[model samples]
Target: MTPASLTDLKAPAKLNLFLHVTGRRADGYHLLQSVFVPIDWCDTLHLHLRTDGQITRHDLTATLPPEDLCLKAARLLQQHSGTSLGADVHIDKQVPWGAGLGGGSSDAATVLKGLNTLWGLHWPTERLAELAVQLGADVPFFIHGRPAWVEGVGEQITPIELPQALFDTPVAVLKPPVAIPTPAIFGSENLRRDEKPAIVADFLAAPKQFGCNNLEEPAKAYSQEVVQALEWMQARFGNSRMTGSGSAVFAWVDTLSHQRQPFTPADVGVSDLTQTGPWVGRMCRLIRQA
Candidate 1:
């Protein structure tokens, strides 16, 4: 017999206002300070409760693990509260993985949040946030789903309200055919690690406080195919930037009248996502598609 019922959930993507690596710990944890802003685009996660004490997952889209952070999040919550109920997880993914959009982290955070409700754990957001950090550095920000000033390896967070108009501007998400691994980019000795840190209060006060991703340059160099994708997006829209590491770049377009959901349209001639060279991406307005 199941102890509880099922519920639905949404996991959104995030953009970093700016990422700064202040220092590195002896244990190899890179301390950081960045402002996280949740855009309307997201991945959908559905959860069903179970009585048999089993936790399983089904990905409706591509197969991914991102080091199994989603599963780890559920296990962490269960261990922390000692909840007996289990969850059958279904991920209806739209957020592109390794796109510097915080998709995986958001998915993990959702599990933490969803299970808390499904199992009747009754943990507050603050408590759930602490548990999220154990799963990943970016998990806490998604729990709040607000623009935030992040510090201390992204564990420390101060939420802020961004102008809703950012979404009004249509943004195009362009993913190159390749994947840029986060670990590899961060591990490179040439990657900049000397930037100073900032306080949360001041950063939120001015959202565009600093420049874009510090990892963008090196990341593109590592993935030449991503450079092509960036070029395509820029050709169609105005200004563009590479999010997070690399392999995915985005641009701002004013109108997305044709798209039911906000999206950057595909390359007219390109259909295959793995062609690796020049593929047309889609055009969508800035809204949470998943």
Candidate 2:
């Protein structure tokens, strides 16, 4: 057995704080505005640099593929920069797929960052962001690795420093037992594409009630039952929205928030469907150690 010379990177999950489909382009691309924040929840990646040209991956998640966008980004950078080293990658997964949390995109960005340092490419952030956009619309923001308000196919990003210390709120992420095909949600006739734009200051001022995910209607139309989860989440907390597309929903509430009344116990249990593969996950607040 040989030790894998690797660098560990945190591939964090992201939520589209709110999504608005401003317009559809001639090429069928949707213009939109939203806030994207990387939560503590994440997938883990370990990259072991190989002197030879060996781009390999050991994926532990059921939904993700070995040759996913992460590896693609690495290869793409290697080709563009002419990096001489290759690497073996391993992932210990926790983020759910098809839930619009940007788990995959984050992993891809982590790879780009890792390889840039491991191979001594020293590519600038602007160069990496450009390459990321070539990979996926959500790719560039992950490299930014900060809370941002995104627009225009998610490529346009402006990082906002969250008041993490000032407003210490608890987050609850619920992934229902379903896998949503993003294309299906986009192509579905019932998708809602209408939402008036708002000033960015409106979001920063009162993020709890600035906007909502316009992609929700179409996502529910395809899945046909997430409405219940959406309703439940909203009823439980003041701030709730469908993150990205479908299947996963999240709420923001105080950690000590009363979940049930003294006289009656409220039903807080989300539905769990026993799909062949893993389905339904509850993400607890990932505490950071000083």
Candidate 3:
């Protein structure tokens, strides 16, 4: 049975602990090896079922495009399931766009999972995850809903149990006013296409030492803002690195100090803030999935 209302469902952001571009497929997809962990920082989604069979959206924040991933996910699910039911999707977005934190993908995944419950679909996660793969590379990871070692253009997933020390580690995620394009980073000649895959045991043995992002160099080159943000985090906290393809970087901090300061363009001149600071960030804890 469908719920009367599904409101304020969270779509959490994910950090790629280490991103290694191992090889390229003939179809131009980049094969990768990375550890993806969900953080507490999240976007909020509210859903109300519609009987008219028309999916629509209401933006609590004007930041997203009209045809964003959430809308696409809803449409895809409706089409695939042949459901006459629809949804009025309302989004209160928190995750930054194009930061490589997989915000869009997470939103889509949340929609898929939430709708499965709200629409009375009763589909298993494995089946929903298969549908999620069509939306984006990172969508399936969110559907899988756990810390995992991700591979094969983000399709293959192996669940990993993190140590308690690393599981509750505090992280400072900082994003400068910039967006790093994934295509540009992958297309760059400087990108390393060959990195020996590390075993899970090695990473488990020394998670801190194993944490690194291969996309960092290209991302830094793409935006000076990314460089400054990374440097700032590095100076404040040790073991700093870019998360995904770029624009946002994070560092493992022993203690988290939550302070919201307005970010000015004079900081980098790349900010897109109309009101809120163009530079957005958060201090989050990695909560291990049961």
Candidate 4:
């Protein structure tokens, strides 16, 4: 029997372990190479099936724009599948937006997944992913639900098993109060667009220390906060890099040294950072699946 409601669905955020712009297409889309992994931090969603054929969204924690991705995703699935069913989506937004964390994309993917079951469509992941890519470059990643090597304007995804050492490693993700517009960074004249393509074996050789985010230089140019966040993370963790486009930086925390203690935000003064402004920080770990 098809359930009328699917509650407490999780939409996990992703980190671009390293992002590189390899080239540009004649259409103006940039070719990319990156390793993407799901993180423990996520947004919670509750979906209720609506027989009246009306899709709606209610934000519980943070206010979302009227036409957020969740609404678009649900509507797309409805139109593509020609389903009479609609959904009432409730989002408990936790992951900060414009942080390069793929929060909106994850939420959209989760809505598609939830509605697939609620409406009894039972579409395969591949079929759903085809629709997902139409929604956003990052949406398909969440639909596929695994760590992947992404390329070709984010449409190409090849799932890979990460080393056990990195599977659950502690990571600190910090976001400044301001959001960096993705277009600003991508359109900047300073952006680098000719990085050498990297292979899976190359990344697997040193998963944690491999490669750099080609988007970082342009991002730093757009937002001084990005520079500050990167420097702040570097000061504490000794290594820091921007994820995806900009304004959010992350570093792998050294857990081996403090094996006796459980990881927390206080360990990295995240609370103090938050008090200083609207800075958002969390101690996260890599999740095997979304």
Query: Pick by lDDT: which candidate is best?
Result: 4
lDDT of 1 by residue, 1-290 (tens): 33354555778877665777778888888877776767666677888888777888866434564337888898888888987878888888777777788888999988888888889888998999888878778888888767677787778887655555555665667776567788988887657877766665565454433456667767877877666666666665545677666656766565455233544336422344455544325453433222
As for candidate 2, its clashing pairs are: none
Which lDDT values do the candidates have, in the order given?
0.70, 0.74, 0.82, 0.88
Q: What CA root-mean-square deviation does each model show from the true structure?
A: 3.9, 4.2, 3.5, 2.0
Q: Which stretches of candidate 4 lie over 4 Å from their true place?
A: 60-63, 255-276
Q: Model 4 over residues 37-74: C-alpha lDDT tens digits?
A: 99999999999989999998876444467888989999
Q: What is the lDDT of residue 191 in candidate 1?
A: 77
- Candidate 1 TM-score to native: 0.83
Q: State how far residue 201 of model 3 sits from its true place (Å).
A: 0.7
Output the better candidate (3/4) by lDDT: 4
Give one digit per residue, the lDDT tens place, for model 3 in 116-207: 98889999999999999899899999998799999999999999988888766677788776787899999887688887877899888878
Against the true structure, candidate 2 has what lDDT?
A: 0.74
Give the per-residue lDDT of model 2 (tens digit) for 96-211: 77789888888889889888877777889889999999899888988888777788887888877655532366566767667788888788787667667767888778776668
Question: TM-scores of all models?
Answer: 0.83, 0.87, 0.91, 0.94
Once model 3 is optimally superposed onto the true structure by TM-score, how far is the C-alpha of residue 260 displaced, in angstroms? 15
**Predicted structure 3: lDDT:** 0.82
Which run of 10 residues does model 4 get worst, by summed lDDT? 258-267
Candidate 1: deviation at residue 206, Å?
Answer: 7.6
Q: Give the TM-score (vs. native) of candidate 4.
A: 0.94
- What are the runs in model 1 whose C-alpha is more than 4 Å off? 1-3, 60-62, 65-67, 196-210, 254-274, 277-290
Clash pairs of candidate 4? none
